[model samples]
Target: MPETPEIPDIPAQIPALREDPETEGTQDAAGTVSGEDGDRGTAEPEAEHGDAGFDLGEPGFDHSAPVVAESLVPESVRQVAARATLPFQAARADLSFGTAFWYNDLIETGGDHEVIRQYLVTATSRTLFEIGQWTLRGDLTDPEQPVDELVMGGFAKRWKVLEGLGVAVMPTVELHLHAERKGWRWDTQEITDGLAAQADDIAAIGAEPMPAYILGHEADDSGRSAHPDRTQRLLAGEVCRPAPDAPLTWSDPLPTGFDGAPVFAALPLPDEQLKLLCLGVALPGEGGPDAPATVVAFADLRPAIHALAPHRRRHWWQRG
Candidate 1:
């Protein structure tokens, strides 16, 4: 492995900045909030109380905790699902999208979400890309913590499949620290300085219980509104074996707004065991014959993920 470069160092201290009063975390059940950022110069409607990939609105659940044994299915995936599988929302041009913390960063692919995906792939690295236009929006957080996990900033990155078929373009963001440090308030320069940093193929599994599961909130329309929070989700198993160049696919349709959903090939192993290959991000899809979803193949992403220095959930970071 090559030596990783040292970017800017972010201290654990929060600036004298106070969070936006209006964006404060909601009461108990609707735990959500957004940190104030500069105007990214885009006319897109801003996320009132952003999602920031929260823990599926379950009050007592801990995202950092390990996945528990199966629970009975309910209204939505929120009940039967593990906290890690749940994702928040993001959008640009008033276009809605879903993104989650896979490994460490807030990832959303451009393949299905052309607008923001294109912006993310083309956006400059180590700099603020629309620090304000708003990247996430959904009802948000647990009472134990102040703010939910947030993508403080985002940048463009590309990864070539091990087979060399094509490249995967992604707009990945840095999740702000969830601890009670700062209430999610940081200027563009502050975020950029922190970003100073900064897929594919398949799972070689030996057959575990459920190889993988797709979890995300698909909107009722392009408006990306899941009004009540609990909505339908796209669920399926992984293509245990896929062609080197082929994008990962599943039997179930990859519903619209499924971008950036994480897939963990449960070789019944740990998330870090194969940070190189077992991890994958879903390609956004529109119901019918949805494009072949992705395996994101983190082979190359691991390096970039570390280079950029995105925040990792305390449990995943400490253990996985």
Candidate 2:
């Protein structure tokens, strides 16, 4: 593994608040008196003597005075009430895969964890192209923890049988995580088995394969490519198939054209065709478009894909 770069200290500019013992039991702006134990008490009613007695309808009484109502409420309670009455506004919810502890482990380890996640995704796609946006570890960990260093990427089980075959097969879900923490270990088999179990549960239900779409430019007569309708069709879930006989290829580094385009097809994998394939030949890893073909499959592939779908869907929805 390559050496991970050093992580810089995160700045903490906010000053810490210190409680002052001398101010204990002091009266606050809200007429309530706070005790040392943190409990609050209302100020004693003004000595009820003769005409000075408290009365709701007293002509000279200022009914809206802070001392009359606000002082009886604790500041914290008042703040909460104010917030509750504020207009509703939607905020993005954190949607991340894997357990919270898993993310916490990455953040705590603090080095190479992010890189490891990305590298895993890149390595797994040795045979297929990765699609969709990479998930952020920060989304899963405590908000106070810095997750700028951790990331995860995913690959679809289905690939273009041969670049433009129209028909595709999805046999598994592939996810990769990258973090730069030293002294951390990964139990590959355990992780793989857990993913397989989830996939099996999904497969048992026989759910239909989810649609996948692609967005790219079509070349003109002069070989210049443009994205006139790619964005709309891709968003509409239009299947993007390669031209017949066109070189079937995908790039690890996304194309410069569509910034957020879907890079993989979302064709569903049929249950009957989900069998594992044992290749009789080894394909060249660095070969060009004409490299010899070698079929590959793993029994756990389909289940893994199912396990990864929900997380990916969350991101997809957010993007939409």
Candidate 3:
């Protein structure tokens, strides 16, 4: 019988052959890359027992596919990015960041301490404070964060407005540096009391002292994890931006009755998409002609945000 050619045990040799790139290729006497499955010299035809190339494209094993950053780029980021394209309008010094509307009504018999306290507690709770700090100080900074200079600049401008409105003198605004949370908040006792004392001055401005602002945010930590490859590197420093849903309003020209007296009516915004912020003001029995006793609404929220930081921007951005 003619000599029979031995079929080298490819399965058995796969492990060792795969490790040796030089000797890994199967040859048909003439060495060349071939797509043939059974070509011994053609890179061992991917070695049936194991893949020839890295499993760069084996089912869910593609190591080189373009990674889409869903977490690094959130909807908020898109909003901010859009803003960056627009020229930040040159801010005016006296331009009120907000406007107010008023109707006539006497102060409620007595202030509801419980309601005020509860509102204060709920509005400025420790939880909100902690969350704000985290958002501003956390390692993973938010991209939409307004820069410190921008925050301080905007704040200084707004503080001047409050000063013009006869509210309390500029209150201290501080930026907490740390990143899972970030925002601006303030103490209105001194400021609010100041405004209350100056009822005449406030009436001149056609409004009463309301809570400056209570903005908070909780960073999506899930985005920080599981997508380290696609995280954004924010610079370290304070960033400022207009407070969310800011530039409070009180313009419900028409007042309704809740218990007895006319209740403050919060008119729908021009876009008819906002709530009315009705702050109780102790007005003289003879209401101010220009300033009625009703809620006000406008689109300037920068004041409230600025009140949280004063002349110095409280925007802090940090990266881990």
Which one wins on TM-score? 1
- The digit string of per-residue lDDT tens for model 3 on 77-100 reads 222221111001112322111111
Q: Give the per-residue lDDT of model 1 (tens digit) for 36-85.
A: 32111122111111223222233212111223333322222343233333
Between candidates 1 and 2, which one is better according to TM-score? 1
**How does candidate 1 fare on TM-score?**
0.43
Question: Candidate 3 at 40: error in angstroms?
Answer: 82
Which residue ranges in model 3 land beyond 4 Å of their true spot?
1-161, 169-320
For each candidate, the alpha-carbon lDDT, in order, equals: 0.32, 0.20, 0.19
Report how far residue 107 has shifted in candidate 3, in Å. Answer: 32
* Cα misplacement distance, residue 272 of candidate 1 (Å): 20
Which 10 consecutive positions of candidate 1 have the poorest summed lDDT?
189-198
lDDT, candidate 2, at 64: 18
Best candidate according to lDDT: 1
lDDT of 2 at 45: 13
Residue 7 displacement in candidate 2 (angstroms): 23
